[model samples]
Target: MGKLSFNRLKRYVNPEVFDFDTTEEIPPLEGIIGQDRAKKAMEFGIKIKQKGYNIFITGITGTGKTSFASSYIKKIARTEERPNDWVYVYNFEKPAQPIAIELPAGMGKQFKKDMEDFVEQLQRDIPKAFESDSYDMQKSEIIKKYQEKKSELMEELNTLAKSFGFVLKDTRTGIISIPVIEGRQISQEEFQQLDEETRKEIEKRAAEFEVKALQIWKEIQSIDKQARDEIKNLDNNIGLFAVGHLIEDLKGRYKVNESVLKYLESVKKDILENIGKRVNKLEEKVLEYFKRDIYLVDVEGERVGVVNGLAVINLGDYEFGKPSRITVTTYPGEEGVVNIERESKMSGRIHDKGVMILTGYLGSKFAKDFPLTLSARVVFEQSYEGVEGDSASSTELYALLSSLAEVSIKQGIAVTGSVNQFGEVQPVGGVTHKIEGFYKVCKEKGLTGEQGVIIPHQNVNNLVLTEEVIEAVKGGLFHIYSVKTIEEGIEILTGKSFEEIYDKVYRKLKYYYGLLSNKKEDKGDK
Candidate 1:
């Protein structure tokens, strides 16, 4: 318990068993490095293709997450075909709603042009067809025949009107028969001069002619309608002749694309009907925000009151663990363990509880012999978002103890785990992520073979890491130590036996107690 064995401190992966000089000699492992569980999970996620089954690649920053994800996704994308482009065109049936069409890439713009050209060509050619000599001659011949038949019918009607003592007259209303006397149309006064019997006879004859006149008018209307129908049919044929080729050409070009072909068919029908409508056509910045130059990596120097405490930084979608410098200062007061984070309202309830636990631990361990008269202030230096969880309880205690003992801790190693009143190191969450986080930082700062993380011994089972981290461990470039107690961690950090640090802290506290007792005695005498 006093001094930990080297094997117990670190579970080293001996490179000799691999029978290879370097990791390059070994085939690259599929998926993430040593994480067999995570690899299987990732494979399952890839095959499922369902919503809410996304794979979350979590670890420390600079752990090759971005690089690996990018390369892997790009490789898969290359094997698949490029997606077809979508185009939206105006809907003729429902003007407010537009229709969407899928076309081969780069074909949408051409389709828009073709539609515009079809409208423009129809506008130009339809007018020309109607004005052409051939079209005019055919239309004129049909009208001439209708006019001749109408003239013959009107002559028959006029002769019948004369036999009935009436004359056929063209007026604004229509062809009408007027009563005539002596060879001229009769005035209203002359008609009145006629006898009642004569008037009755005249009215009877005029009624008979009126029926015949109605028949002639019906015949003339039929002839006129027939002529108009012939002209309309000629016009439609000319229009189809003018633009049918243009539509057929578009259909042939996009025949292979079903969506495009359907869209073109609609266009053909619409153009023939409406004639003319309208249509129309990272990571570095992330590092800059969350990463501070001072907080990026661990330094390789010993300092009292300052310990590298591990923590997880959560950026919503991305969460990574990193080391924060936990610092402590002691003064002559009975304020107990003063958590500066709690004082500044930046510490969570759990973290405050952990700090209170520190007081309990110190009171039991060191204050049993003398009154605990020393005031210690513990702080998570340079932290802004506030501290949470008891994960760093062990770290804070290490910093507080180091301040009391005036012992310098190894700055290269970062510690994570919560310590109870009995000083037993308890497990914390995200142990795998925390270890990889420090490993990445150490790798960036240059691994000195001594740079490592101290995790709770219980969390050793959660060590699913990357291949690169495993390779580094195999080569002794980095390490991960699992400890069962604060005593074991203090020995690793200060490179001295825990008994030595305990003696130093005890002596300091005893001296402070003597000073406090003498001050109280002097005040009583006064």
Candidate 2:
């Protein structure tokens, strides 16, 4: 099995077969370098608009799955029409079921303000209508008519009482009939002095007069009730006049919106039913939840111990990727590598393991000359949410290395990938998303052709970029580089070869080792 015939093993083609002198002289292949099947599948999924024809992007973490999905969506969203704003209003008929109304963009806020203004105007004008001179005059007229009617009823009762030898009198106890003898009212003691037969006759006549007076009193009570009803009707009519014009104005404003017209009608009816009630003002203001901030964008200058690390922020229904500054600080010590995120309990176990791998990488690369005698603290600056992946392992390493070597990495570029102890850059998920995210930031800050992203070489096939990014790349406004090793990434970041950086880092570690050794010697001597 190990041996092969000369004809089979030594098959060779003529040099004349190729037209180009060298590979560099030939034009590069078009489109992506690999994964033809993936690219085609993505294109098909993105172009199809039918429901249930969704594209399921599956890959290990850091493969750029979310990056691809979000980039395409955002690109398409830019060209689409703005969505309608939805609002819920109180349903007077079915209070438990609030009605949902859809309004054109920005119209929702206008509708809300208009309703508030209507209520305020009603509060001001309704009270004025009730307190006006015309309303008071009308009210006084109704009271005057009721008083005249009561006077007439009282006169009729007095005449009836006189015929019965008892005159109707007005007193503190109310209208009463008193006994009268010889055309003059008599005291209770004189009335009692009369004989039993005379007293009986007087009592019978007074009882008869009381029956007639009771009928007149009932009539007077009915008139009082009628007057009250008239005054109430006047108040209702005045209230309606004060608020009807306001409701009509609001209806005119939302003339074409059937839902708004219906809601306003309900509101008007409710207001008139309970005229003097005050409506509470809105307590919360409309806040924009999805907005861009330049804080996470990359700066224009290079700095030591700092590298732009990419990350994905998922806020369900609105997920996005952005860049975070990963910073490292190194000093002479035996503590190896200290992850500030882990120390503060803001790092997941995977991230802690990634940091531990940094120690392994440092020892493997530079420990032959001296023990890895350095204290390195790594952190993602301006980050509050806990970091949870090994995706930024390469980014953290670059920052640590830059800190150790006193080298500055370019701020215009971002990086994502996990690294092994051998310093090989390994693939991480969301590569497309991370790259696109950084591209967006650089674009906002203004692309300078020098801005780009360095990703793991193994993740090259994960790219399915938006048209905007593709155009930017075609115009040389941005770039993307796939790296196989930490050295390759560092060279791109610092604009220096891997050997030069290694020399600088090794010398610093050697210096640290010597300084610590000298201090120990001095202590032992003392």
Candidate 3:
């Protein structure tokens, strides 16, 4: 537990050194840096192509899950058959149930355009087809044929009525029969002068003529119906002829895209059925909604009790990681480490536990010799939502230790790792992203060779970083340290050994213990 070797007390990251101003082009990232097992998992997920065996990537934030998945899937897609594209079309059978059609990649956009152009073209062709001289002449001929039959029916009825000594009359009140004598309508006086027998005969004969007139009207109604059916067929045939060429062209173009061919056929019917309706522009709106801005990294600065910790926020399908600034404040009291996050309900169970673990570590190390009485608060700055994870526990302890020892940690570097009461650093998730987030900030602010990150030694195998970060490290403009214990982190951040720091911290605690004791006794309090 004592007299540790200088080499054992520190494990330098030792990034590759190079001329700061070299113009050599750093190669593009061909693969993830240190995650071989994850790479294999990715391959297995992509190759199987089976149902219900979807891939679920599990790792701490900043471990490069999104980056790895996106790049790998994109690379795989280039060689594999592309996924089908989907489009929403208006359903005619069930208007509320919009139909979803799937087309091949790169064809959805074209199909959508073709539909729009079809809509515009329909507006021009439909009126011309309806207004053409041929269409009008054909329609007029049907009406004239029906009218000739109606005239012949009237003439037959009039001849039959004459034989019955009655007139077959057409009037606004409808068809009627009137008494006739010698090819002329009879006056009321003349009708009364006729004998009762003659009058009854004339009335019976007029009733027979009425029956014949009704049969003619029935035949006329049938002819009108036949003419309407013919006109409707003519209209539909003309419309289909105008649209068939446009649709068949698309069907031939996307013959390999089965879904697109079906969609085009549906579109053809829809364009004719709804000549007055507009085409949908849904893809444009979706693209506009998904357009977003990505923040690359965190800013660098030096302050006591403040350290940069990595965190991730998933915006549904899209995800990103940034650095969280953790800060701690301490004062004299009988209280222990006060977790502001826990008290305000801004932290999760694991995070609350991580802070408590630091208290245990502090008591076991220094309070064993004296009363560890102090009031301190630890908080994650600018954290608006509940934070979960012990990954930043080690960083929080570092910040607390800096505040207690009055040591200033470098702002250019960030850290991620969990710690225990034994002061051993444990592995954390998203080690790669945490390093890269801080690196971007440092790079933006100008990475002084000193800017880098400290991570747990066990987490080294989990790293998969971007090419820019790799090149920066190689050029000596950045670094990444892997520490196994808190002492190494302390030495790296403060440039002082744990023994040197503990010596000063122990003396300070003892002096405070005695001072508090004297005050308690003077006031006759426990």
Candidate 4:
């Protein structure tokens, strides 16, 4: 059929090519969910910072150290309207070197201003107590005088009643009269001297006066009670206002002195000592440079010192120059060593020096490995210099693998997990931060449709993505994926499903073992 002119004919319609930029939409912070513990810690730290305490968050790299710190600071800055300042420092490469940071020295001044404002507001609300209102004071004075007068009148009335051989008893209806002498006889001369009509008129008038006096006394008592109650209430209100004023005044007049400074000094000393002990222990365990055998002692020279696990000779108490080398002989079973060198490099001195050391180490490693063909470098980012545990091994391994593969792992995708020697991925710390770090990065990068992070499946319980991230995820700007194994991680990174790639790896492992099994079987048969 004339060579079947297939070249001239189009085989079929052109295959459709789907273009999806995996890095296009950075995952919203919302999609980077999980990590309640880390979120809670961050929130607490923010609250503490607002109350005037500097915060330090410690965790392994890829566990969200920087992300949580940054997020918390951002939240506080956004929500709180205060004059307090916020400062963020990150990318420290050397933890052993001091980091110099400056804080506001005017915090006391600002506090005073705040107190003044508070006092002004209180004074306005309670002007009567703060101001010398003469009306109130006068009312109190008049009430006191009336009470004294009422007491005197009552005493006089009681004395008159006793002279008349009558006892007066107080009753709710008023004072009642009772005869002290029961059925007592009266002198005829005294009875005759008082005309019957005149006597009857006098008794009636006396009884009426008594009734009027009792009514007057009750009225006085009522007025006195009312005045006293009012005075008591006013005193309480004024006293409370005075207390508020006193607090404000004290706040304004507060001054830090030598004693306070000394106490602070002691506190600083304690903190430094504790921090130093921790550093020493960590150095002993993880600092490779400290283990070099650099100093040795010679018995012939009567030396009695050791350095870097070697006994050192005093050399007549000489101060050696830079790059000095020392040699020493070992005891019978020990190997002899020589030519241990020292460098004269001096580090910077500052408060919080450890951060510098950590930063320098990480920075140097990063610098050396940048454009790395087959290597990766990592550090405990934003840790403020502390001993992070071994939970970051798997993340480190993945970073190394990504570097080696020359694959650009999206910054939006942070990972946290541990890895065994066999390369099995394991769970890790601060799952929240790991998620949030990538989420923040994504947010900063402008959310695209494809942004997300891969984390350990076991860390699902730890997910506590912030509200912003959650909202963004709901809006479809971000996503989060959980993985259990290295294979799954590889699939996520490579954009290929594990179902498609796992069989090849499984076959390879099986084939290698099968060959060994066949060789053993043949040997047994022979």
Each candidate: RMSD to true structure?
Answer: 46.3, 41.8, 43.5, 44.7
Q: TM-score for candidate 1, please give it.
A: 0.47
Q: Encode model 2's per-residue lDDT on 356-444: one tens digit a residue.
A: 99999989999886787999889998765567667899999999999999999999989989887889887777777677777766765
Q: Which sections of candidate 4 miss by over 4 Å? A: 1-384, 496-526
Query: Which tens-of-lDDT digit does each residue in 1-526 have in candidate 1?
Result: 4888788886888777888798788764345655667656665666775678677889767655666677667777687777677888777678798888888777778888887887788778866665566865775566555655655666566667778888654322344567977765665678889999988888888878778678877887787677656655665666667767877887887788787667667766665554311100012222332345644434588899888887764322344667678999997788988889889976765578789999888889999987789898898877755566678999999999999999999988899998888899877777776777777666666679888889889778767889998998899988888999999999999999999999999999998999899999999999
What is the alpha-carbon lDDT of model 1 when measured against the actual structure? 0.75
Residues forming the 10-long window of minimal summed lDDT in candidate 4: 306-315
lDDT of 4 by residue, 1-526 (tens): 5666776776664435535445465453521135677667667756664555766656556765676567657766877765533222221244465333233455555544654675575445444442344534554365545544554565566556655555444322335554443433233355467678855764665576576567666766676666555554454455454444544344344334333233333433333233212212212221122123222111111111110011111111111111111112221111111111101111111111222232233233332423211111233321211222234444444433343333433433444554444345545445554455445434543566676666667667767778987887788887777877766776655555645444442343344345656777999999
Better of 3 and 4 by lDDT: 3
lDDT on C-alpha atoms for all candidate structures: 0.75, 0.78, 0.71, 0.43
Pairs that clash in candidate 1: 33-467
Q: Quick one: best TM-score, which candidate?
A: 2
- State model 2's lDDT: 0.78
TM-score (C-alpha) between model 2 and the true structure: 0.48
lDDT of 3 by residue, 1-526 (tens): 7888788877775555654444455644544557788889788878996788888877777767788788888888889877877888777668899878777677778878987887788778766665566865775565555545554555566667777777543321345566977655665689889999989888787777678667766876676677656655665676777788878877887788766676677777765665322111122222222222132223455677677777643221233446667888766677789888789866655578789988888898999867797778898876655666678889899888887877777777788888878888877666665676567556545667888889899778878889989998999989899999998998887878888888866776677678788888989964
At residue 525, what lDDT does model 4 achieve? 100
Against the hidden reference, what TM-scores do the models get?
A: 0.47, 0.48, 0.45, 0.26
